[model samples]
Target: MSRPHRPGSGIRSAWWCEFSTRTPAFGDGDERVLLRAQSAETPTQVMVWIRLAVRVLLSGFDPRDTERAYHWLDHGQWEAVARLADGEPYAFTAAAGRTHVEWSARPVLFLPLAHTATGPLGRCAEPALCACTARGHRCGGHRR
Candidate 1:
């Protein structure tokens, strides 16, 4: 017989974001699904934006309209997803707990760009038109 496939065995540690449109109480909608991750060693701006997008999406989720709401994985919750990934169930819970505590202690400041007369003058308005430069990425400065 073949041994069960193990997930996350290659990576030492990582940060994962999960979203679900169902509640545990009902046990019907997709729950504890692993969505994406950021390496523990180096995190990129794109991954940070993905996390921010999750936050924004969750904030706007209306359970009343969809009959379910989405949420991110945090606060010592990781067993179900770990099982699905075929990793040590408690590993994620422990790591996520540590990460949660660490982040709660030191919160990053995020400032949204100010809107212009036409519209936001940054990639926040039109990402496709944004240009990459030596210094950093710059917005196309076009109105939507």
Candidate 2:
């Protein structure tokens, strides 16, 4: 019913960052999951740090850990932007795929650095904050 946000900026494509999620694969009443990004391929030596914002309505992990996990992204270079309990098995593997942006479980209207083929998406006032809910209206943004 809802779609996840996608970013089309060169940050993930041109710069070569890959995004993926980790979730439990076995029986569980409770579990931890994580969504993160890494350099699948890049030419520059300067590390590209991702500012991940989790807007999930409900997560398997502790809700209190959400905001704190978001800030953890700033401190690490291609590390777990989100943390979840490892009690569950995960088959997730980070693959190099081109995208402009992405969301965890729901679609969101994320700001792009520039205008895309679809249309222009305004930049987020907070540099660290890129995800937003534009209701049901299309915001004309992509992650490729």
Candidate 3:
């Protein structure tokens, strides 16, 4: 079994994601914990975090030219959406979860789990992701 998730304490701070191509990499639980410390709730602290993120990501890009890029960790996976040399849309995602991450070129509708699906705790999935997108988490698939 996996270790229980404690809130904003211990090594796990709910869930954290970095937008870098390297450094922490994806699925590194310890790094996730470290990144969570960025929640300082101040403008300066937030700016520092953003600068760190930008420095890490820019380390991989060409300095002489501008390139469109976006990357972030989602549910412990590193997701990158960028344009190729030919300017074609490209996206890649990888995770340590049991259910394969599914994406489609065409728009896809995802259904949410019924309220009854969650027990009394209402933790059908990661309570955070549930409140936002329909993505499930850490449950070995089956939509949590």
Question: Model 1, 26-116: lDDT tens per residue?
Answer: 5454344333322222133323433444444544444432222132334222333334244221221112211210111111222344578
User: Could you tell me which 10 consecutive residues in candidate 1 have the lowest summed lDDT?
Assistant: 98-107
Which is the winner by lDDT between candidate 2 and candidate 3? 2
So what's the TM-score on candidate 2? Answer: 0.22
Query: Which sections of candidate 1 miss by over 4 Å?
Result: 1-22, 25-30, 38-51, 62-144
Q: Over the stretch 7-45, how does candidate 3's per-residue lDDT look in tens digits? A: 542232211222222234456632322222212222233
lDDT of 3: 0.30
TM-score ranking from best candidate downward: 3, 2, 1
Estimate every model's Cα lDDT from 0 to 1. 0.32, 0.32, 0.30
Task: Give the best candidate by TM-score.
Answer: 3
Runs in model 3 with CA error above 4 Å? Answer: 1-40, 65-136, 139-144
Q: Which ten residues in a row have the lowest lDDT in candidate 3?
A: 99-108
Error of 3 at 9 (Å): 26
lDDT of 1 at 133: 40
Across 43-88, the per-residue lDDT of candidate 2 in tens digits comes to 2211323332232322323544444444443453333322212111
